[model samples]
Target: MDLLEAIRKRRSVREYTGEPVDDAVLRELIEAAVQAPSAINQQPWTFVVIKDADRLAQISRKAKSHLLKASLSEPAHSFREMLNDPDFDIFYHAPALVVIAAADPTDWAVEDCALAAENLMLAAYAMDLGTCWIGFAQNWLATPEGKAELGIPATYAPIAPIVVGHPRRPPPPVPRKNPDILWIDAQTHCA
Candidate 1:
């Protein structure tokens, strides 16, 4: 698919078919991810692919538990109920999880990883695959126990915990908001 088309149509998929995603396809998505631009060419991203159904479910459970105990007073109330639910799979039963990480906690690492993640997500959508970046897993995945369980390195930071799988159905397009522009020309006076 064309890059712009992918950009416009790509959605954060929640429902997924239970079929396993091919390794080659995952590799292709990672290759596409690495092609993304990085700050000062740090190219600091690392990946951990978890295709084990048991493990993804385990992580999902742990993540939900962790989020439930966290402070969910007001804004976090949005997730309070779902996290409390016994059957809400954080990964939505996706067959693959491609975790994007940063080797070092540098200033630009998160930004760089975010760009790579966007690339990976777009590539998945273009290939008729669905992907969702699970933010609920981020905090737990950063903990020592979470790292040990996933075999993630001690110093590495889990930037994006994305689940990849076949979509149960095509997600309807969500409308985008118009950009709030502040165009400043040479003739415009400084504030």
Candidate 2:
């Protein structure tokens, strides 16, 4: 699929078939992520692929608490539910969990990591796999339990945890808003 097609068709998938993602396919996705551009070529990113069901659940449990408190409406609320749902755990039993981490130094590392994640999501969609960018886990991942469960070093920080698998439900294209919000000119809008 073309980049535009992938960008337009990609959706934040929550429901996934209980299918295992092949290592080769996962590698392809990660390669796309690594190909993303970084600030000043500081490609400070690391990925942790979690496959064990028990560990995935442990991480989810740690994250669920924060999700419950998040100020979100309907689908987002359902997102939290899906995370806690017995059937939803393991991200619908998708074979892999990828934790995105960046070196904790550069000021632009967050943006770099986010771009990498977006690339990964788009790549997964092109490959016909479902992907979800999980942010609620930040707090949980920072805790002792999370660190121990995910096996993170003291220096590395988790940027996001993405779930990947074959999508069970077909996601419709997300509507686009006006692009006028982007100002290309150098003229300042505010004094």
Q: What's model 1's TM-score?
A: 0.97
**Top TM-score model:** 1
Error of 2 at 57 (Å): 1.3
lDDT of 1 by residue, 1-191 (tens): 79899899999899998899999999999999999999999899999999999999899999888888887669878888888888999999999999999987888999999999999999999999999999999999999998898797899999999999999998899999999999998889986
Clashing pairs in 1: none
RMSD for all candidates, in order, please.
1.0, 3.4
- State each model's CA lDDT, in order: 0.93, 0.79
Clashing pairs in 2: none
C-alpha RMSD of candidate 2? 3.4
What are the runs in model 1 whose C-alpha is more than 4 Å off? none
